[model samples]
Target: METKKHALLSASSSHKWLNHGPIALLEAMVPEEESSEAAEQGTAAHAMAEHFLKLKLNQASVLEDSIYHDEDMERYCQDYANFVVEHKESLGENTLLFIEQRLDFSPYVPEGFGTGDAVLISDKILHLIDFKYGRYYVNPENNTQLLLYALGALNLVDSIYDIEEVRMTIYQPRIGNVSTWTMDTGPILEWANGELKVKAMQAYKGEGNLEYGDWLGMTKIKAISKDRAKHHLELRKYQLREAHLLNDEEMAEVLSHVDDLVRWGKDVKEFAQKQAVENDKHYPGFKLVEGRSSRRYVNVKSVEQRAAEQGIQDIYQHSLLPLTKLESKLGKEKFHDIFGDLITKPLGEPTLVSESDGRPEIVKHDVNADFK
Candidate 1:
């Protein structure tokens, strides 16, 4: 497995830390977690893209061996490679292509560095392409990560190339999205010296106030994908269920839209609570009040010292952290790397779900099968 070095204020995580600088402090307490399967898959896709881009651009590159390749990955990666190289070709002979380029934006962001997927530079244009394998629709406009990458890329050839404008492109082939955001060199340098420097300092020191809904942030692509899936399933189910298969009770249960109802109920409750708590939004028939809480320690250290002074022996009990909390703290990759072969996910209790759910049904056992 290839290991990656992640800086405290890495460009990839610029979105999180930039929004609320103090999160960098909170994250420092937590170890790097094991990357989720999706993250690893994305890495594999990047490797594949690098392989193809190198081959297409006449640069020596090896196709990395990994378990994450699929038909979609191959197709998307090839297309992205083609897009990058083609864009370079269109820019003419003056354009130079750099793949998987190492970028250092530390002048603005302290100790900051990142890898640009593709950097095509001409005398007057510095084109930075970032390939996102995920389904999320990453907007190119004001994308902090891409902006930082563009800055880093510019720093590399700025003195040599009279790059008048920097064009940052987010090439997300999976979602058929190709977005570009452009900024003149003067404005970018101004932002770098002004906003970027301030934010980077705040992030470096982990000093800014926490942003509300940081944890609640969800990618637009996920929401889009879910809605699209639900729409298709809703339309398809009508055709599939032309004839009734269930009795009255079962039919009524299906008609209740239990899944949607449960989801909506939870969402509404959560949404209202967040609004009332965070924004002080006053909703009809609802008032903000402190909820019930079990007693714990105001300060664990203070309580411990007091207990010791009062001769309160055995005041502590030890137990392993819950898996979910541990996973969140350590990250999926680090957790798995440290505790490989020690963790297991047992079969969950089966429950009725809509046909649109991705999980496969458990095989049913027939008692009469042996007799046959």
Candidate 2:
């Protein structure tokens, strides 16, 4: 049994094989004591199964609510298990073949692999399908995991089937979508060899450290340069004062330079703030609206309302301002010109309502009324 640390430290190429096997291989890498504790508490998969059973029996509605514990994982496991149980017949035939059948491909490839999911062989073609439970978008066709399974199947059946093309499909039931991609073994193998060669070189150079060395080096350089510039500015100010002693022209020149510097600094600060707002609009988080309480689930509708209230005119009702329109109107420079004053103002507490307030007071102003 490989230790968890050792398993993780192994090459990324090995992940293809390890990930294809039972989840238990990775599970065993965890400490026995920890695994025992998890088993005693009821594994997340068990909880998910219980949840699904309840939903099926009671016809309960599952809400898109926040979860602090392992609810998400449990739900995913339950869904997959439910799918398997519900579609047993369609899946049973392929599942049996997957479990029992072994193909020989020594003629074309020296090594082969096995897959856990359903496999279909038809008309001199082989297809591999794997399901993912997560909500994030994953392109099924180009996925390396699916590709690895295809490669293994290709090796086993190529001799008997005369396989010309391999088709890999990733079925994401959570999102109700399937992505399929085809791969030609020859070109793929060549690309794989090239990537492996680069990995070997990186390993040899001791450049495989996971720590972000490039970012750290850049951060250090930036800090030192900023400190040097600050010191230089202070020294320059002192020298300017000394040189301006009894010299009116030099004093005027120094004052003008200082004014320009102050103006430039303000302009840069405004530009940066506007750029931040534009960037924030593109972030996925902006599409997620937080509930009044931290424990509550996020609501997309609330996010849309909040975004609209922020003066973001969504012409297409897409909840987000289109990038092209944003660039034309709310780009960094124009953003500050339009919203700088509003951005700088403090959001004061809301005024309290009293019984005497009755109907809300309305203030109306008109040039004709004033003139009359």
Candidate 3:
């Protein structure tokens, strides 16, 4: 008898698939290697930091042309350094601010990631501050770049220090305002080990492929819209029936079709609106545009491979490796829900997902495995 190879099953149905529509479309439109190249060229902060750290001087220059002109940004950096130094005593001796420092997380990726204008590191507290020179309104509480730096720092210092709280700040110097979030290392680590690990596996397996009719493509969109329409119709009918419980049999029969009636009404309205737009010569036909946000899913193996290709040798030296068997046994839906909630919460809200609000009491460390 020949032995059959059993395929590994994912704990969460949502986990085995990518959810963000824009990323899915981009992945479909561009090849993986090409997308990676675009990502590398677009962001030179990592590269610049790596170069600056090699210098033996106490100061270095980092430039972002989009944020501000070179001279203006340099001036802003000087002002920020002075501000931190003026308030140095309040920030505490163990806390470091307005200093150019590189954190070594793993051997493959070194002190390449840079902290912005300031960092606060007390015995058990680590904070990252970014200075924005632009006039446009920005909510830094949920800023991804700040969070990435926090991740790098957490990986470096968590094991060495009894870190109690980690904070990230976005300082809009032009607006004279700041947004900040305090994070707990324990829950973040748990999320990394659980939900992030599953996402990583999916990315590594190249499961992002979706045909037109696949659930992740056009087919899923139509199916979901139809399902939502059906659900709304059913709910409306149930409410109407309950309201007219004493109606005659004929009236009840009419009421029974209320859901269908409402659905038809909505469909007619949509059809008319679309027709009007089509008839207008100046009007552009409806276009499905991808959103402007980026969705980051974990791909530990790919990340490891990329690191190795870049001559990174000490991946798991400082950081913990994926606890495969242990992670596999945990429920997938639970992990997705936990991470999803963290990602979807709006900025300034009293949730782990939004860290911009000045209030500090809302931070909680509960871990759930249930998918919602």
lDDT scores in order: 0.78, 0.46, 0.47
| Model 3 per-residue lDDT tens digits across residues 95-159 | 55435445432221211244344556667777776655546566655454455466667766666
Which of candidates 1 and 2 reaches a greater lDDT? 1
| Per-residue lDDT of 159 in model 3 | 62
The regions of model 2 sitting more than 4 angstroms off are: 1-96, 99-115, 197-372
Tens digits of per-residue lDDT for model 1 on 245-307? Answer: 666775665554555544544655765686679778998888988899899779999988998
**In candidate 3, how many Å is residue 343 off?**
43
Which candidate gets the maximum lDDT versus the true structure? 1
Those runs of model 1 whose alpha carbons end farther than 4 Å from true positions after fitting are 1-4, 214-372
lDDT of 3 at 278: 59
Provide TM-scores for the models: 0.58, 0.33, 0.37
> Between candidates 2 and 3, which one is better according to lDDT?
3
Error of 2 at 231 (Å): 24
What lDDT is obtained when candidate 1 is compared to the true structure? 0.78
Q: For candidate 2, write residues 1-372 as lDDT tens digits.
A: 642332221221333222222222332343332244434333333345444644654545343422322434555556654554444345344332242133322122223233335455654456665555555567764565555556557666656666566667665654766667877666656645565334433433334433211121222122222332353255364464454463666555455345334544554444344445655534334343443855553887786788788977653434656544553455545766775565554655555443344556544578798777
Which 10 successive residues of model 2 have the least lDDT summed? 212-221
